[model samples]
Target: MPHSHYAPRQHASARADAPRQHQPARPDAPRQHTSARADAPRQHQPARPDAPRMSSTTSSIPFVSASMDLSQDPSSPYYVHPSDNPASALVSPVLNGENYNHWSIGMKRSLISKQKLALIDGSILMPPKTDPTYKAWERANNMVISWITRSVSPSIAQSIVWMDKTYEIWEELEERLSQGNLYRIAELHQCIFNFRQGELDISNYFTQLKILWDELDNFRPLPKCTCEAMPDTKKYFMEDRVIAFLRGLNDTYAGIRSQIMILEPLPSLRKVFSLVIQQERQTFGNETDMKVMAINGPWRGRGSSVNRGR
Candidate 1:
């Protein structure tokens, strides 16, 4: 029995020896295989009864909320079509209703009209009164008058001399004619007439003759008649008396030709003649007949009748 002794055995604790238990499956919780209907819809929601409902068929229409949101949100990278831009749409309404373009055009036209009217009214017009051209015209007229005056003086003076010389020669012939010195008278008359004719040729006698007649109309008794005339009361039978007077003269004499040539100094003799003739006509009756008589040869002499009747 002493050899059969045994070691004492210890009992095990219940908490240390117990195993971990698993959680029980939840019945009301979501499962990994549940259908999508179990989650809320992100893309669509049911409209509240009081909220405005958009028509499903009216998809083309834009929502006012979207437009306002786009305008308010600068960060949104969105824009309306060019046709729908507010500024562009307002342009036609403003122009047509307010006539903005028309008003601008009318204003410009009014300004231009005012400028044109001012021009036509001569408000800013300037005259050429102080210009060189005006002065030149005045000077030219004065020069013409001076030239005319100078030219006429010489012609008139020369004509007077010729007339005086002619008268003296005629007086000498009359003295001899009255004394019954027929040969001497005839010779003297012929010589003097020829001399007068030559003087006429040199002086443009017909022209000077007209000037003389014109001077005679206003004749106050001068110291002498430059061209002599028989007393008006004395009648001569010689129809060609003036021509007879001219025929007797010759050109060789110095006084005859010198007086004729003196007319050359008068450039405006023709003009002076016209003026004188006009003045003479006004003062007296037209002396055209006398002028014609002077130009044409004196009246033709009557022929002697033959005694063949016996």
Candidate 2:
């Protein structure tokens, strides 16, 4: 298994002390708007003569122009869409330490959808106060924190709420939950070896086996080097998986498995699965045929007796 190298997010204190390039304010910069009489009482202005009277439904309602593209806005990265409301986005499967891998994957996908993945992975750098992008960056970071807090169960959230950075929270949860990876892999391997499909439908049986296979693969990903030997490694690994899959199949598939094993060049896992599925369909088809024959047996017997009598 190729392990992921996750660098922890730098602490806030470290970032604060780092040197920054500052741009000097220009003498020709735009002047701030100010009231002529600062001490004067505020007064409401009359509406323009051409202005339409506000209806009850339209009063005080802000209308966004159709041409407005939030994505083009400088602060759009921090702007959460209505469809991506934080509370709604928090509907992801809760992490209870047991299903960390699945939960993490789901949570990550949700974050990615909202363009907040950088907050979790530290892909985006924090900008200085003078930077124009600072506000958007800060808003996005806070939104992610809120989302994280709302998504997790109270017990899990409480433990991580103390961490400020999204990456820190992410790293903390991973450290706490991903402790039994090796043990889990061993358990899955044993389970695979001892699996027996019994009376379960072939589709369901294969689905169960696939879940374990996928989990095992995630825990121990195949090597990435595309050397000539990589194919052999993949073949060896896939062969083991296929064997495990076939070994667990019902006795009815014995002939199919035997035929597959005797082939000169072994089939891929997908091809093997397809063959097994076909065999399962055929098995059911045979059962159906036997049922039909049985139903017609009495009729055929009666017809023969009549012919003999004639």
Candidate 3:
């Protein structure tokens, strides 16, 4: 064992001749290699040929500018051009300071549809003796009569005579009244009495007079009497007393001139006259037709010829 321990040592060259060892890699080289590998896929791929591309200049345009352009175009749905606005013409310099008031179509139509006045009848201008104004008018007329009596002038005497005769006729008509014909006579009596009395109350008198005037306004001229005069028969008087009274008022009272003048035009009076005359003629015509029918009945029809008395 001593011999073996001393002989165990190998040659120094052989001991130094171990297998050739590889050198350790540098740290910077591996880090550089790792970075190159990571970048390789990005460098090999080609850019997409069909993808959409946006220009910075075009994208920078304002959205409001595009909207405004569309609004100005006439063909666009959102168009609102300056020339198309109606209010633009009304805003001129000349009209700016003016205060213009305008009415709507409906308001104008409503204004024109209203009634402004009532139609007045001429017969209503005369009132009867029972009216308060008629009494006042009578009192005033009595004063006038007293004055006339005191003076006793020829003209005044004539007026008194006329008034007396008128009163007589009116009294007869009022007492034996049958138709609307007497209304005018009654009104005339009241008016004449009022004229004679200057101090008559005019308030109720005017109102009553208006009614009578309106009534007489419907009168017309007398028709030619067709019937043969029967001896001792009373004649039917057809004169319009209301017209006569109006004429008398005009002649007697200068203060009432305006009222009297209003009747001068008398278009409605003329119309009433024509209508009444036509109606009267028609009535007479109907009566004559009835008489003819009665006369012809016996000849035309097979019946006992009994004379149908009219």
Candidate 4:
């Protein structure tokens, strides 16, 4: 008789080479119920009501960063509050504590370009509440404040942060920095006195010299005398400037200096500057010619030797 199928095989060794078999799942087992959380779609957080909204049209502008743009885009890193800050893209000169005069001049040019000079120059006073221009005045005031805050260093900005009016900030900066202190004037004077052309080309030398002159002038400007002695004073001042310029030149200018010194009444500083510049050009030309001749000299001798050998 055949053995029952459910019974363990008597010849287990004979079935060892066959694949192993496992029982299937029973119908009595409980089924799994999948949670909605595992399959639900993701949701985005709503934007804040107070946040700036970027206009779709803004995408058309080239090279505009969201932060630097004045458009309503709070997501931009450089976005400034419209009511509290000026547009960050405004042209401004970086103002360090030093060189206030030049800085102020450059800032003025920038303000003029923007037509906002009246804001800082005290030409436009505060408008009355009933005036139509009051809104404009307020807008200009905010813009000027923004410009000042962005232009100055943090330490300097702290000094003028409390200033409300454009003129007030301007005046405070001028009073604090523009007044030529005696010590500063002396330092600039010494700088001018010791300045020399050295190895610098005439243009660079003159540029450095002019910087000293400008700084010195800021400290102790030429007197604006209109009296009977003004003519003599002007002449003396002119001669002094001429002497200062001539003294700083290279030794190569010695002959030119002598020619200028003997000019009876001495020409104007402008005329003297022109003459010196022309002399510099001529000197440079001569130097270039000499260099060319020296370089050619060696080649010419080599060529002659080669021809003679041939």
Q: Point out the worst 10-residue segment of candidate 2 by lDDT.
A: 301-310
Q: Please list the residue runs of candidate 1 whose C-alpha ends up more than 4 Å from where it truly belongs after superposition.
A: 1-195, 199-203, 220-310
Error of 2 at 117 (Å): 1.1
Which predicted model would earn the best lDDT? 2
Candidate 3, residue 206: lDDT: 38
Could you arrange the candidates by TM-score from highest to lowest?
2, 4, 3, 1
Q: What is the lDDT of residue 193 in candidate 4?
A: 86
- Per-residue lDDT of model 1, residues 1-310, tens digit only: 4333322111223333342222223322345325344444422345442244445435435544433543224232222223332222111222221233332233334324322222222232322667423333333223222222222234332433333122232233234333433444355444434444332332244454444333332222224333445532122312233333233334333343344335543224344334434433453333333443454544521232222111
Give lDDT for model 1: 0.33
Between which residue pairs do clashes occur in model 2? none
The candidate, 1 or 3, that scores higher on TM-score is: 3
> Tens digit of lDDT per residue, candidate 3, span 1-310?
8776655555444555543221234566777898898778666543332222334445556544543543344543223334332222212121111111111122223222311001011112223866534443343233323322333334333544555222332233233333444555576556644642122222222345555454444443344455666321222221233344334332224434344346543333344334433443453555434444444455554343333221
Model 4, span 1-310: residue lDDT tens: 3566535565564475342331123222322223334334222223432233444445535435422333234432123345544645343456677768778877888777666677788887787978655655676677778887788777888888887888889988989887666777788778888888775555567778888777777666778878999899889977887888888888888889999999889899889888987887676755434443444567543333221110
Q: Give lDDT for model 2.
A: 0.71
Model 4: colliding residue pairs = 67-78
Per-candidate local distance difference test: 0.33, 0.71, 0.36, 0.68
lDDT of 2 by residue, 109-196 (tens): 8777767777778677676888666666676677788887887788998997777678888888899999999999999889888888
TM-scores for every predicted model: 0.13, 0.65, 0.14, 0.59
Backbone clashes per model, in order? 17, 0, 25, 1
* 2 or 4, greater by TM-score: 2
